[model samples]
Each structure stands twice: as C-alpha cells, then as structure tokens.
Target: MNTELPALILGGLAAGFAIFSIGLAAVIGPKRFNRAKLEPYECGIEPTPHAVGGGPGTAAGQRFPVKYYLTAMLFIIFDIEIVFLYPWAVHFDALGVFGLAAMALFVLNVSVAYAYEWRRGGLSWD
Candidate 1:
C-alpha cells in the first residue's frame, strides 16, 4: 500500500500510451515528401543560410538574437509573479501583515527588474 503506487502507475500508463501512439502513427501514416514540406519553417519568415560556409543548396539556419530569449524570460518572470500573487491574495486575511510585507518585497524586486529592463531597452521589440 505504498502512497506513490498510483502516481507510478499513472506515469507508466502515460508513457506506454505515448510510445504506442507514435509507433502506430509511423506504421500507418502516409509517407509524403515535397520540397516545401522538407524546408524548415521560421515563424513564416524565409529561412536564411548559415552564417559560415553556407551557400546555395546548403542547410539553411540562422541564430536568433539574444533579445528574443530575453523577452521570453521577462514574460515568464512577470507571469510567475502573477501566479504567486493570486495565492497570496486568496489567503490575505489569514497571512495578515506578514503576507503583506512578503508580497510587497516580492513586488518591489519584480518592479526593479522591470524598470531595469525598460531603461536598458529590453522591453523594446526593435
């Protein structure tokens, strides 16, 4: 009667199902090949050739700018802030001043990061 038995069983079933589905698809799926289908897609933008030694008929690839990852990380940071805020709000009465102080500190830290990003132009798309 291990407490973890149910979780382990559920995990095994999910993994088995995933593997079975993939195998089934490979066995029964139609094999279709075309130039357009083979080419890599980049958010509707035409793929560019590699920066070095990439010419005609070579594999096309491009390095995304650091700004793209930075923007994504910023979004995640703010989104996580909201996740923490919602639970704190729900338990505001029970937590009293301690929760209020903790949330204020958390908000201050997040705001500082936001202000820094804004000042450094990390928030700008261009």
Candidate 2:
C-alpha cells in the first residue's frame, strides 16, 4: 500500500483539478443565449431552414461525405496497431522466433486489409 501512495496522490490531484476546471468554466462562462447561438453549426456556415419541397437540400441529404470518416477510422486502427508493434520490436530479442513469426503474421494481415481496402476504392478521393 505504501508503494501505491504516490499513484493515489497523483490520481486524486488529477480528479481534483478536473473538477476545479469544470466548476470554474461553469461559473465564469457567458450566460447570454439566442436563436443564432443555440442553432446547430455547419462548420462555419450559418444554419439554414429546410425547404418546403423534399429534395437534395433536405437535412438528411446535406450530410458531409462518408469517405472522411472511413479514412479517419482506418488511420486510428493502423495507428494503434503500430503502437503495439513498437513495444514488441524493442523486446524482439527476448521474444525470439515465435515473436518474430507472430509479428510477421500480424503485419501480413494488416497489409492484406490495406490492400483490400485500396483495391475496393476505400481510399479513393473522387
């Protein structure tokens, strides 16, 4: 328990600071509200009222491209995989042949998925 004292103190400090910051924000932030400020923002554009006729301008159809989301998700997945690989690489000698083979298989799997996505136009800009 003595060994954990520093960790406990650090965690408690972090939690206390978080609560303090949130309380400060709540107390000091602006209270003025209006229709414009409350409306849903579109990047930097002002919110537009939906037209009477159902068309491409509808709220649902006005959504941004899905390609951006796919790209971001793929980046996050591969980035996390690389993070795991770095630790394994540093201990490669201790891990030996089995570790090397396992890492190789993992890399191969990642490569196959990347290639498949690439071939299927997942990364295409148009």
Candidate 3:
C-alpha cells in the first residue's frame, strides 16, 4: 500500500488541476455568442449553393471519400493490436511459448487483412 501512495497523490493532483483549469476557463472566457458561431463548421470550405434546399444536411453537403474511413479503421485495428504486444512483451518470460504462438497468429491475421486491403486498392488514393 505504501508503494501506491505516490501514484495516488499524483493522480489526485492531476485531477484537481484539470478541474481548476475547466473552472477558470468557464469563469474567464467570453460569454458572447451568435448564429455563425453556433452553426456547424465546414472544413474552411465555402458553403454550397444548395445548402438551404433539398433537406437539412442534404446531398449538397460535402461527401467524404470512403477511403478515409477504411484507412482510419485499418489504422485503429493495427494500432490496438500493437498496443496488446506491449503488455505481452513486458511479461514475456512468464507467458512463454503460448504467448509467443498466440502473438504470431495475431500478427499473421492482421497482416493477411492488410495485404487483402492493399490488393483491393483500399489503400490507394484515386
């Protein structure tokens, strides 16, 4: 329990500082607000001529390419898988052959999916 005391104190101080910052922002920040500020921001792109017509957020709204989503999902999947490797690496001696075999299979599975996506032009920019 003594070893945990420093961590607990550090955590409490960090949390308290976060709360203080939020409170300070609220108290000192501007209160002025307006329609433009309230409106959803497009990525610095000029609003389309058809914005007010068709429907709320109609086909006129900018359509992001699907490649963006696919690439993001692939990144998240591999990133999470790599994160799992860190803990296994930390406890490598204890986990032994079973952990080694399991990690190998995991890497193989992710690599296969990555190759498939690459072959399908999922990784390409049009």
The best candidate in terms of lDDT: 1
Encode model 1's per-residue lDDT on 4-109: one tens digit a residue: 9999999999999999999999999999989888878655555455553346776554545567677888899889887998989899999999999999999999
Candidate 1 Cα misplacement greater than 4 A, ranges: 1-40, 51-63
How far out, in Å, is residue 26 in model 3? 15
* Candidate 2 C-alpha lDDT tens digits along 66-126: 6767888988988887788998879999999999999999999999988998999888877
Any idea what lDDT model 2 has?
Answer: 0.82
How far residue 23's Cα lies from its native spot in candidate 2, in Å, is 21
Model 2, backbone clash pairs (residues 3+ apart or across chains), number: 0
**Model 2: CA > 4 A from native:** 1-48, 51-64
> Candidate 1, TM-score vs. the true structure?
0.56
Clashes per candidate, residues 3 or more apart or on different chains: 0, 0, 0
42-96, model 3: which lDDT tens digit per residue?
Answer: 6444566554445665755555445666777878987887898898889999999
Task: Return the lDDT, model 2, position 45.
Answer: 40
User: Would you list the rank order by TM-score, best first?
Assistant: 3, 1, 2
Pairs of residues at least 3 apart in sequence or in different chains that clash in candidate 3: none
| Candidate that beats the other on lDDT, 1 or 2, i.e. the better one | 1
lDDT of 1: 0.83
